[model samples]
Target chain A: MHGETAPPPTGPFADPALYTEITQFYAWHMALMDEGEPDAWADAYTEDAVFEEPGRTNVLRGREAIRASITKRTAELAAAGTVMRHWMSNLAVTPQPDGTLRATYYSLAMRAPRGERPDIFAHVVCRDALVREGERWLIRHRHVGIDALEK
Target chain B: MHGETAPPPTGPFADPALYTEITQFYAWHMALMDEGEPDAWADAYTEDAVFEEPGRTNVLRGREAIRASITKRTAELAAAGTVMRHWMSNLAVTPQPDGTLRATYYSLAMRAPRGERPDIFAHVVCRDALVREGERWLIRHRHVGIDALEK
Candidate 1:
């Protein structure tokens, strides 16, 4: 029931403040992950969130599970001396009838061997269901679809 | 100057009508391409639009060139007896300061030989700058990034 603000008369189509919040959500999420703060990154999700990668049959439900999965991945990457950066773009947010926001964006995962030129390892399109908790938008469900399969 | 409609007091954050229009834009674009209506698909772009697929060095500017490129690709697919379907998801649309909209989505292209189980051929994240031409939203610039490289 946070819909008291009147929309602008012209110019941008969406509420500028709402848009800024969503964009910042992604930016902060990425920064947390890249900085090796798995727990902090996972805090962006709701307690009962569902995380899935359809192409890989990876599904982790609940915030604790999600955090564990990311932590394990981070450890593996660190052990291999590979640094990964995820670049997300082309984000679209939609308001659903059920009082939730659906967000979609494309992600490019670039990986390097410590000090090498990063090569694109994965290109993914992500769909997220987000809910507002207090003043923050936390993810409730996230689905990632990978573009191509390797040999 | 198209922003006169007031947003709903509750439910989704985006203007429902604008969200519908943007989603339908993608639906129509995909349908036109899948149905072999290249001209109609190309019409979705502005006269001076830029279409780029950096992974393939494919940059087609202008509506006519964009049309030609799609037409050629359609013919080649037809000749090879491949029926391709492009599935787009995770679509996010943002209103820019320049009175244009930026749309980002994920696309998964599936291809099959007439009667085979379609296999994923490509995954892409697309970022589009769209302009409103009368009542329709048209692409002003499009960038497609592929997910993976081939061996």
Candidate 2:
């Protein structure tokens, strides 16, 4: 293993390089989404991707659907002078035998209004299926589950 | 430089290994502090560490002093049914010529009350000097500045 994480390392997780890459990916990827760049954010996913939000009965399939959904949401937030930041913690990544990564993390969605303090909009547990192509890793599927629906 | 962090990297920051170590160190270290283990949290720092919170006029010198401070605060928080979690983002780790790491990150201090949603208690910029001992990285000096005083 690598770093100080608790582990009996297995598969791709054993490589510290993979660990660093995955963490950096989300850190960069989340900022694009939070900053209202739907095209850039959606490009991080595969062309045929599945996005699931069971609490809202929103299971959007395909990259175009994901891009369109976020574009609409970000436009509304921009008009309202609000910014959403997603904080990911306690990440656990496992490499599946089928050559995909099963990554899970606790996500905190913080909503900050212009010139105002931020609050937790939602607390979610996110699981992602990632596929590697060339040197880039793309999200093939994302399943987001909320604890205690905010709405 | 490795991973997907914004470029041009230098020194230890260019080493993906160091990046992994520093990130993992904080992720593990913060949990110990947030979980109310003052001793464990303080032990992550050097014995002669300096902790500074300029806005609060609290400049603690030495690990024992740091432990004492957190212990008191954590006790109060536990009695009042509160938990404080620090979410770090946009980390920048630079290696000084003196063989120490100059690390900086944006910290979101989230305050959670019992059975209630958490909110941002404070948004602070934290900078730390880290020294490596064998495979362990310990905090030598930490200076935290608040963007806007919450109180």
TM-score of each: 0.59, 0.61
Q: How displaced is residue B102 in candidate 1, in Å?
A: 0.9
User: lDDT for every model?
Assistant: 0.74, 0.79
In candidate 2, list every pair of residues with a backbone clash. Answer: none
lDDT of 1 by residue, A67-86 (tens): 88989988888788766656
Whole-structure CA lDDT of model 2: 0.79
lDDT, candidate 2, B1-151, per-residue tens: 4778867555444377676667667766776767677767877888899999987857999988988898888899889877676778888999888889999999877776644666668888999999987656889999999886668
Candidate number achieving the greatest TM-score relative to the actual structure: 2
Q: Summarize candidate 1's per-residue lDDT along B1-151 as a digit string, tens digits.
A: 0112423211223344565677788988898998899999999899999999885767988999999999999999888888888876555566777889887766767677777776656666689999988988899999987654322
For model 1, what is the error of residue A89's alpha carbon versus the real structure, in angstroms, after optimal superposition? 20
**Weakest 10 consecutive residues of candidate 1 chain B by summed lDDT:** B1-10
lDDT of 2 by residue, A1-151 (tens): 1234623222233247777678889999999989889899999889999999885657999999999998888899899989999889856567788989988766888888878987678766689999998989999999986542345
